[model samples]
Target chain A: MLLALATASFRIESSFRAQFWFKLLSGVLNVIARVSIWQSVFLHGAGSTDISLPQMITYAILGATTFSTWDATQILREIGADIRSGNVVSHLMRPYSYPVSLYARQLGARAHEMLMIGLPVLVVMGSVYGFQLPASPGHAALFILSLLLSIFLLFTVSIAASMIGFWVMDMLALEWSLRGTLALFSGGLVPLWFYPDAVANTVLYLPFAWISFYPLAIYLGELDLLSSLLHLLYGLSWAVVSAVLVALMWRAACRRMIVQGG
Target chain B: MRQSLSLYLYLIRLQLRTRLQYRASLIIGWVAQAFGYASVYGAIWIVASRFEKLGGWVWPEIALMLGFHVLGYALGALFTLVQLRRMEELVRLGTYDTLLVRPVSPWAYLVFSGFNIEYGGHIALGIGMMVWALPQLGMDWSLLTVLQLVASLISAALLTGSILTMIAAMALVLTRSRYLFGIYFDFWELSRYPITIFAMPLQFVLLSVVPLGYMAYVPIAALLGKPVPVIGEAAPFTAILAGPFMVGVAILVWQSCQRRYQGAGG
Candidate 1:
C-alpha cells in the first residue's frame, strides 16, 4: 500500500514541468549563493579559522543539498491546508493511518525531487566550486548512515510539529516558529564551528544538530571514527524518541479532530 | 488617488477586525514572524562577524545593510502577502471571477485585503538594528546624507514590493508559481551580503537582471562611501529611481496579465 501511494505521489510530482525546472534552478542558485558568501569570507575576512576553505565549500554543498531534502514550512502548509479545507476528514476515513500514509507519499515525492532536482544541483555546483570528498572510507560509510538517520529524524520532528496544527487556530505561526527553530539549530546554513563556545556547546547536543550538523560533521571527518560511531548511536536514539513523539501526538491530534469534527 | 488611498485604508480597517478576531493567532503570528526574522538575521551576523570583515564591509556596516533589507522585505511582504498566497489560490478555485467584478482595481483590492500589521515585529527589529548601527558608524551626518538614507530605505521597500507584485502577477497565467516564489527568494538571499562577495558576472546579474542590489547593498554602499558594484558613487542615487521604475513595470505586467487571464475555468 505504501509503495502504491508513493507511486501515486511520484506520478503527481512528475506532472508539474514548471515546478521541476524551478526547483532545479533554485537549487543551483542556492548552492552558488552559499559558496560565494563563504569564498568572500575566506578571502577578505581574517582567515585564521582551523577549517580550510575547501572544507567549508564542501560543507556548503552538503548543507544546501540536505536542506532541500525537507522543508518544515512546506510540510506544515500541506497539513494546514488539508485541515482548513476539510480534506483531512476524508484522509481519516481511509484505510491506512493518515500520518503513515502522508509519510509514504512525502517519501515518494521527495525522492523524485531529490533525484530530479537535488542531484543535478549537487553535481553542477560541486564541479563549479570544488567540494571535498568524504574524509575516508569509514567516514564515507558512516556519513551515509548518519544522512539516512537525519532524514528520518527531521521528518519525525517536523510531523510532530505539524500535529500541533490540529489545536492551533492558525498554522502560519506554528509553521514559522518551527522553521525558525530548525534553521537556527540545524546548522544547515552556518556551521556550529563559527558559534561561540557557550552557545555551540548547548546547541551541539540539540536534536536539531542531528538533522544537519552531525551528519555533515561525520562526512567531513570532524570527529574521529569512534566518536562518529558514538554520535550515530546518539542520532539513532533521537530518531527513535522523535518517532515515538510523533506517534503520541498523532493519537492526540486524532482525538481532537474527531471531537471537533475537523 | 486620494479616494483610492481612503478606500484602501477602509479595507485594511475591516481586515484588522477580522484578523484580530482570533487574538491568540494574531499574537502568535506576530511573535513567530519577529522571532523568525531575528534568528535568521542573527545567524547571518554571528557568522559574518566571525571574520574581520565580509567583502570589506565591517560587522557594523553589515548590520546596517541587514536592517535596511529586513525592513524593506517586511514592508514589501505587508503589501503583498495575501496576494502571494491568494492569487494562485483564488485563480485555482475559480473565486477570482468575483474579484474581477468588484468595482475597485483588483490590485488595490488585493493589496488592501492582505494588509497585515503582524510585520510590526520585523519593522521594529529592523529599526532597532539601524539605530544600534548608526551610532557606531560615527559618520558625519548631514541633512543631505539623512535624506539620502531615507530615500534608500523607501526605495528598498518599494523595489521589494514591486518585484513581489510582478511575481504574484505570474499566477494569472501560470497557476503553479510556488516554485517561482522559491526562486525569487533565492535571489533575494544574495542581497543580504555585499554583492562584491560574488564574482563580477554574478554581481552584474544582480544589478542589471534582477536589480536586487538596489534593494539594499548598492544604496547602502553609496551612502557609506564604500565602492559600489557596477556603477560607482552615483549608484545610491540611481537606486532611488529603480523603485518607481519597477513599480511602473509591475503595473504594466499586472494589467496585461489580467487582460490575458481566462479565469480558472480555462
Candidate 2:
C-alpha cells in the first residue's frame, strides 16, 4: 500500500501529458536561462568566473532536475496549510507521527517524480547540452550518498519552515521568504563557488548547500574524495542539528494547536 | 466601455481594501518578496561585476535589465497574476460559479478582482533601481528612446497578461492545466538575460512564438541602440501589436471555454 502511494504520482503523470510537458518545458527553460547567464559571463566576462562554461551548463541542468523530485517548498506549503486548518488533527490521531507519515508519503511521491519526470528530463537535457557522469565508480557512489543526504537536509528545512503555521495566518509570506533564502543559500540558482568570497564560504557551510550543490559538485568530480567525505559528515551534522530543531518546533506547534483548538 | 472600466476599477479597489485588512500578512509578504528578488539580482551583480561587461552588457546595464524584469512582473501581479493564480482555488471552493452568474464578464471579473497592492511596492522598488543604474550606464536617452521604453513596457505587460489569460482560460476547462499555469513562471525566468545568448532556434521561439523579448530585452536593446539578433530592433513592434491582439484572442478562447465549463465540484 505504501508502495502504491509512492507510485501514485506516476499515475497523475501518466494520466495527463500536460504535466510531463510542463515539467519538461520548465526544466528546459531553467537550463537555457542558466546557460544564457553563464554564456554571457564566460563569453564576454570570462575574466571572473572560475567554473568553465561547460561546467555551468552541467550544473544548471542538474540543479533544475532536483525539482523533478518532490520539492521542499511544495511539501512545506502543503503541510503548513494542513496544520493551519487543523487538518493535521486527522494525522495527529493516527498511530504514527504526523511528520513521519508525511515523510513516508512524500518519499513515495518523489519516487514517482524520479521515474516520470527526473530521469526523462535528464535524458532530454543530456542529449541537448550533454551531462557529465561521475569520473569514477567511487564518485558515483559518493554522489548517490550526497543526493540522499541532501533530501534528508531538505526535509529538515521543510519541517522547520512548515512550523510557521503555528503563528502565521498565511503561509505564502513564510514560504516565499524561505524559498528565497533556500535558492540563494542552496546554490539552486548559482553554484556557491561563483559567489563572493564571504558569501561562498558562509553558504558552503550552511545546511542549504547540501540540498543540491555539493552533490552535483561531487558528481562533477569538483570535490576530492577526502573533501567529499568530510562534507558528507558535515551535512549529516547539520541534519542532526536541524532534526533537533524540528522536534522542538513540533512540540511548540502541538501546544499552539491545542490552545487555538478548532 | 466606460461602465466596464469603472466596474473594473471598483472591483480592483474592493480587492485592495480586502488585502489591506490583512495588513500584517501584506507587509511580511512584500518583505519576503523583496528579499527573494534581492538575492537573485545580488548574485547576478556579484558575478556580472566581476568582469568589465557580460555579452556586451555592463553591471549597470544588468541592473536595468533586472529592473525591467521586476517592474514587468510587478505590473502583472497588481492587475491579474494573483487573481489568475487563485482561479483554481475558486474552482475547488465553487466560488468560480459565483463569477459566472455576475452581470459583468466573468473573464474580466476573474482577471481583475484580486488586486495585489504589494506589487506596487515592488514596482516602486524597480523604479528606484532604474534611477540608480541609468545614470551610470551613460546612455543618452532621447525622447524617442523614452517613448519606446514606455511602449515596450505596455507591450510586455499586455503580452504577459494575454498569455496568462489564455492559460487560465484553458485551465478553466482542463482543471489540471492550472498546475501547469503555476509552473509558467519558469518561462518568464528566461527573460532575465539578453536573448542574444541563446542559440538561433531559441531566439526564434522567444521572438516569434512566445515573444519574451518584449518583456525584458527588446526594450533595453531599443534604448541602448543594440540590435536584437535574428529579428532586429523591430521585434518589439511585433510585441506591441501582438499584446492587444492576443487579449482579443484570449477573450474569444475564454468565451468558448466557458461554454464548455462543467460547473466545478465533481
Candidate 3:
C-alpha cells in the first residue's frame, strides 16, 4: 500500500517538476534519518530502557500520512464548487463515478504528500535525532502493516466528511471544523498520551483514534500481535460503517437534487 | 485622517451590529473555542502538577504566558477574520477592485472590513484567567504594575496586528502561499513558552526573524523585571512602537504588491 501511494505521489509531483520525484524520495529518506537521530538524543537524555525506537518511527509516519489527508477537504470544496456552477452534471453523465474519480485524484495527491512531505520529515527526524530501530524484522513488518491500516482509516474518515457536500451547498465550514477536530482527536498535533486521562479515555473509543494513533502504537510494539489485530479489526469496522453511511447520504442527496431552474 | 478614522469607526460598528444578529451562534462558538483551549491548558496544568516546572516556567508564570498568548490570539481573531477570508475570495474573484474604488484608503477598508466580535468572548475569558491567576502569583496591588499590564497588552495587540497584516500583504502577492501562515502559527505555539528555554539560535530566530517575542515575550519579560535586550528597560514603550513600525512595513509591502496585482480573474 505504501509503495502504491508513494508511486502515485511521485507521478503527480513529477508532472509538476522534472526533479520533484527524485527530490521527494531523497527528502523522505532524509526526514526518516533525522527523526531517528532526534529520538536517539531524546533516548540518551531520558534513557532508552522504557521507549522503543521502531515504534516512534512508525507513530511519526502514521502522523505524517494523517496530516497529508488535509487536502481531502480542498478536493471536496472544488467538487462542491463544480456542482454549484452546473459543471458537475456534465461530469456525472460521463461513464465514470464522480466521487470515485475524486477519490482517485485525492489518493494520487495524498501519495505525493506522503512522499514529499511525510517521508522527508521522517528521514530528517531519523538522521538528525536518531530513533531506535525495531527489535526484529517481524516487528518492522508489523509496523508496516499497521501504517497501511492507518492510511485506510484516514481515507474512510475524509471520504465520509466530503460526502456531506452531496446535500449541503457549502461544506467549507463543516469541513474545516471537522478537519480541526480530527487533527486534535487523532493525535496528529500531540500524542493522545499527552491528553488528560479522562479525555483520552473518551476519545480512544472514537473512530478518530484509529486514523493515526492505533496504528502508530501497534508499530511501536506498544501492542502485541493480538492487540494489533484487534486495532486493525476496529479500524476496518469503522471503515465499513462510514462507507455505508456515506452511501446512504449520497442516495438521499441524489433524490433531493433540485438543479436550479436555468 | 479624522474623516478616515470616523469611517473606520463606523465600519467597526457596522460589523458589530451584523455579528449581533447571530447571538446564539456567537455564544456557542465562543463556548466551544474557550472549552477547546481550556482542555489544552488543563492538560498542561495537570502535567505541571506532576513536576514543579517544565523549562523553568512555574504554573503561575506559565499561566501568565497562557493569558498573554490567548489575549494576542483573541485580538488577532477579532481583527483579522475578514481580512483573512477576503484574502482567498479577493484572489479567486479579483474583487479587490471594489475596495480600490472606495473613497477611503483601500488598505483601511480591507483591514477593518470584517470584524468577528465573537472573539471578544475569548478576550474576556483571557482576562478572567489573568484576574484569577494574578493573586496566586503573589502580585502586589500597585499603580505601576497596573499601568505596566495595560501598556504591555496594548503593545501585544500592536505586535499581533502588525504580524497578521504583514502576512495578509504577502497573501496579496502570492495568493496560494497561505499555508505559510499555518507554518507561522507553529511559531506562535512555540511562543507559549518562555524564550529562555530555547537554544540561542532559535531564540534569535523567534526574537529577531519572526518578532513573535515582541508579541508576548518582551512585554512579559519587562513585567517580570527580566532583561530583554531587544526592548530594553522600557519594553512596554518599545513594544508599542514596534507595532506601528511593523504595520508601516506591511502597508508599504501591500502597496508594492498592489502595483503588481494582475487580478486573479478577468
Which candidate leads the pack in DockQ?
1
Local error of candidate 1 at residue B112 (angstroms): 1.6
Interface RMSD to the true structure, each candidate: 1.3, 2.0, 7.4
Candidate 2 stretches with Cα past 4 Å from truth are A1-17, A48-50, A67-70, A259-262, B88-97, B239-242, B259-266
The order of the candidates by lDDT, greatest first, is 1, 2, 3
**Quick one: best TM-score, which candidate?**
1
Cα TM-score per model: 0.95, 0.91, 0.79
Please write out the lDDT profile of model 3 over residues A1-262, one tens digit for every residue: 4445445755866575524543444345333332333343343333223444555554555455334344455765676677677787676567765555655666677676666666666666556445556545666777677666666666666666666666655454445556666656776544576566788898887888876677566656677877777777777788778767767766676677667666
Rank order by DockQ, top first?
A: 1, 2, 3
Instruction: RMSD for all candidates, in order, please.
Output: 2.0, 2.7, 5.3
Name the regions of candidate 3 deviating beyond 4 angstroms. A1-99, A162-173, A194-196, B19-52, B84-94, B118-121, B128-132, B171-179, B224-241, B255-266
What TM-score, to 2 decimals, does candidate 2 have?
Answer: 0.91
**Where's the lowest-lDDT run of ten residues in candidate 1 chain B?**
B81-90
TM-score of chain B of 2: 0.90
The order of the candidates by TM-score, greatest first, is 1, 2, 3
Weakest 10 consecutive residues of candidate 2 chain A by summed lDDT: A64-73
lDDT of 1 by residue, A37-116 (tens): 88988987884788889999999987887654336357888988988877888887789988888788777877787778
Better of 1 and 3 by TM-score: 1
Ten-residue stretch with the least lDDT total in model 2 chain B: B233-242
Candidate 1's C-alpha runs over 4 A off are A259-262, B264-266
